[model samples]
Target: MTGSRSSSRRALLGAGAVLIPVAAVAVPVVQRAAERSAFLALCAAWHEAKDTHEQFYADNVRTFEDEQRVAGEIDRLDNVALRLEREIAGAPARTCAEMHAKAKVAERMGERASEDIAHSLVADILREGPGA
Candidate 1:
C-alpha cells in the first residue's frame, strides 16, 4: 500500500510537470484567438454599417440634407474602418491571418448575422462614445 501510494504521487507530479508548460503555452494562444475574434467582429460590423449606408443612398432619392447627413455618417464610419485596419496591421502575424480568415467567413454568412453584429457594435459605440 505504501509503495502504491508513492507511485501514484510520482505519476501525478509527472503529469503536472508536463501539463504546466503546455498550459502556459496554451494561455497566450487562447488570448490571441480571443483578440482576433474581437477584431473580426468589429470588421464585420463596420462593413455592415458602411454597406447599409451606401445601399440606402443608392436605392432612394434624397434631399440635400439627407445626402449631407449620410455623407457625414459615411465619413465617420470610414474613419472607424481606417482605425480598425491600422489596429489589425499592428497585431501579431498569426492573429492578423486569423482575423482575416474569420472575417471572410463572417462576410459569407450574409446580412442577417452582420446586422445583428452591427446593431450590437453601434449600441456599444453609442454607449461608450468615440474611441471606445
Candidate 2:
C-alpha cells in the first residue's frame, strides 16, 4: 500500500510539472488576446462615437445619449477583466507605449473626439496595467 501511494504521489507531481509550463504559456497568451480584444473594442467605439463624444463631453453635453455611450464605455473597460497586480508584475511597457501613442492621436483629433476620451483611455490602460 505504501509503495502504491508513493508511486501515485510521484505521478501526480510529474503531471503537475508538465502542466505548469503549459499553463504558464497559455495564461499569458489568453491574457494578451483578451487585452487586444478590449483595446480593439475601445478603438472601434471611439471611431464610431468620436463626434458624438466631442459634442457630448466638450461642448453641448447631450445628456441622455451621452449617458448611454458612457455606460457602454465603462462596461467595455470592465470586460477586459485584467488582473492588474499580477499583470503589472509582468512586463507591459511596450504595449503601454503603443496605447499611449494611439491615445495621443485620438486627442489631437478630438475635433472628432474630446480630450476627455483620450484621458479616459490612458487612465484606464494604466490602471489595468496588463502585459502585452
Report the number of the highest-TM-score candidate.
Answer: 1
Candidate 1's TM-score:
0.53
Off by over 4 Å in 2: 51-132
Q: lDDT scores for all predictions?
A: 0.59, 0.55
**Model 1, span 1-132: residue lDDT tens:** 999999999999999999999999999999877876776666566567557656766765368776776676667766765555454334332343553543453465455344443444345445445554
Please write out the lDDT profile of model 2 over residues 4-116, one tens digit for every residue.
99999999999999999999999999988887666555554544454444444555335877666677654454333222212322323236554664564455454654444
Query: TM-score of every model?
Result: 0.53, 0.39
Which candidate number maximizes lDDT? 1
Pairs with backbone N, CA or C atoms under 3 Å apart (clashes), candidate 1: none
Lowest lDDT block of 10, candidate 1? 87-96
